[model samples]
Target: MQICGGGRYDNLIGLFSEDKGKDVQNKNVPAVGFAYGFDRVIEALKMQNLSPEFENRKILITFVSDEFKDYCVKVVKELRERNITADLDITDRKVRKAMEYANNKYKYVIIVGKKEVEENKVTLRDMESGEQKFLGVEEIKFE
Candidate 1:
């Protein structure tokens, strides 16, 4: 979410030779500059109504027990660091409710529990296909 633009401005210094009504000076030089405005891009995204089919893949990390909360957060962080869109369930909700939310809003869900954490693995579920599989962090894949 950034835009940068710059161009050469030859003979532009003469225009600024007189500053604050001070004594005018005779000089000239080329100038170039660039600026990035993320706020404007964010505003445009909010205003635009894109098709649902164009949405990016979303992953939800759900915990099987409170004991694995830290591990769940770590997994989410790792995914995000890899530029993967991921979220975590921190509301202390039941598995059924969490799965429902993930199925509705996320494309995939990674179930983290004691066993998975102990084995340094996670249960990856494909929401659309209702298919599930166990995979190590290094074995994880995305669409």
Candidate 2:
């Protein structure tokens, strides 16, 4: 019969303790916490027809030069490992033309260039929403 379950903090003991230094004793000692059942939330949303069916849309990872081709391959491999639909510009088009092709073909674009490779980062741009984010090379994990 678990109607609800959550965590709480009991700071009364810490608040009343006097043996510790006055500076430590005077610290703010309010308790705080939260609880959530994601499964229940999903069920509720489904009942309301508000749950979105996640779709795997294609993304394009464009490389501007032969120098960055290997890095581009690595990024493509990482994206695919995450089950993300992705492709690369094997055509070796110019930067502007590649961007054009990506915009037309994919929902999102991951741009990797010489300077980006040197800086160990990549730029991700959403074609439809026009939003963008720059991610550090190491920060991106496939899984």
Candidate 3:
């Protein structure tokens, strides 16, 4: 795929200037221009088996109550700061439905409920293995 093309164009800028052949007030400007075929680049990467593996690092967060929205948001913010892809689910869906959604898209699921809030911990579930473990808020590390 021809992903991109660029080359020097000394008169390119000059052609766009108010003066017919002068890029600046009294002089021509040497310039270069480039364009990328983003779709073609993505196709090439897919063909080369180089596409991003988002599921490997993506996580879904599910909280039990609306009261814990702030806490969940804080956790999500911290995870993002660490370069971890985290998503907080505050929808009205049941926990089971949320887990199902996570299983389809994320590698891990963080579940926080009243017990977890009181204990300052979260239940982490491995979506692929169906395993769950408890970890402190500060102890969770994905990166």
Best by TM-score: 3
Q: State residue 39's C-alpha deviation in candidate 2, in Å.
A: 34
RMSD after CA superposition, every candidate:
9.6, 14.5, 7.3
| Model 3: per-residue Cα lDDT at residue 129 | 94
Task: Please write out the lDDT profile of model 3 over residues 1-143, one tens digit for every residue.
Answer: 68999999886665677777443644467778899988888778878888665447788999887888787888889888877778999799778999988877899999988988888788989899999999975677654
Off by over 4 Å in 3: 1-53
lDDT of 1 by residue, 24-119 (tens): 344556678777666665455666754233234578888878999999888888887876778898998877899997767788888988889989
lDDT of each: 0.77, 0.71, 0.81
Model 1 residue 8 lDDT score: 86
- Which pairs of residues have clashing backbones in candidate 3? none
TM-score of each: 0.62, 0.54, 0.63
Ranking by lDDT: 3, 1, 2
Which lDDT tens digits does candidate 2 get at residues 60-128? 788777889899888888777876777888885886787787776677788888778987788887788
Question: For model 2, what is the C-alpha lDDT against the true structure?
Answer: 0.71
Model 3 RMSD to the real structure?
7.3
Model 2 weakest 10-residue run by lDDT: 50-59
Best by lDDT: 3
